[model samples]
Target: MTLKHGPIKNLDMEGMTMIFAVAKPEILKTLKVGDKVTFEADRVKGRLTVVTIAKSK
Candidate 1:
């Protein structure tokens, strides 16, 4: 799995979390809104957009 570092915009009931990174959209497309992901950021560096999230059990 590729390691990505970015700012997490939002986290919903779904498993997915919206993230803002310098990475290209194509790379972002690969990630599902509800897919479990890991990121790193110091502060909010971007806008939070709506994303499909997975329900947590």
Candidate 2:
């Protein structure tokens, strides 16, 4: 999935749209297109990955 996100604090990345690998497949089940979310990401095994994610409320 391509995500357009604000600056990611932990990853030290500027806000930009990009594809991120989800660490858990179930994380995708809870989300759909256009849902706003707050998440944490990391470089896992040489891939940029979503470590934890949740719907923004």
Candidate 3:
């Protein structure tokens, strides 16, 4: 999946770090820690970080 908004925090050869806010629970479920992802926020386009994953159980 692609993220439409977020701030690019850190980056490396392997991947990048992104800090974005999401509202949909369904979308959050599809993500996991260390998972590779794509970011698309306004003019920014590149890989992102699944640095952390939080869910309600």
Candidate 4:
């Protein structure tokens, strides 16, 4: 799914919108299109992957 996220400072990336494959698709069931979230992503097998997610405070 596409996520509109701010800069991932840890990754040294600037803010932008992009597509991300979720590590746990089940987590999608708990999220809505516009919900603010904090997540961690990594390059797995040459793909940008969302490894963890949580509702933003």
Best by TM-score: 2
* Selected candidate, larger lDDT, 1 vs 3: 3
Rank candidates by lDDT, best first: 2, 4, 3, 1
Better of 1 and 4 by TM-score: 4
lDDT at 5, model 4:
86
TM-score of 4: 0.84
Candidate 4's residue-wise lDDT over 11-52, tens digit each? 778889999888889877788888999899887887888989
Give the Å shift of residue 53 in candidate 4.
0.8
* Runs of candidate 4 exceeding 4 Å displacement: none
Instruction: Write one digit per residue (lDDT tens) for candidate 1, span 1-57.
Output: 222324344432333324443333444555664466444332334534333322234
- Model 3 lDDT tens row, 1-57: 333333444532333343544433465676676555554232234433343444424
In TM-score terms, candidate 3 sits at 0.33
Please give the CA lDDT of all the candidate structures: 0.38, 0.90, 0.42, 0.85
Using all chains and alpha carbons, the TM-scores for the candidates as numbered come to 0.28, 0.90, 0.33, 0.84
Least accurate 10 contiguous residues by lDDT in model 4: 6-15
Which pairs in model 4 have colliding backbones? none
Q: What residue pairs clash in candidate 3, if any at all? A: none
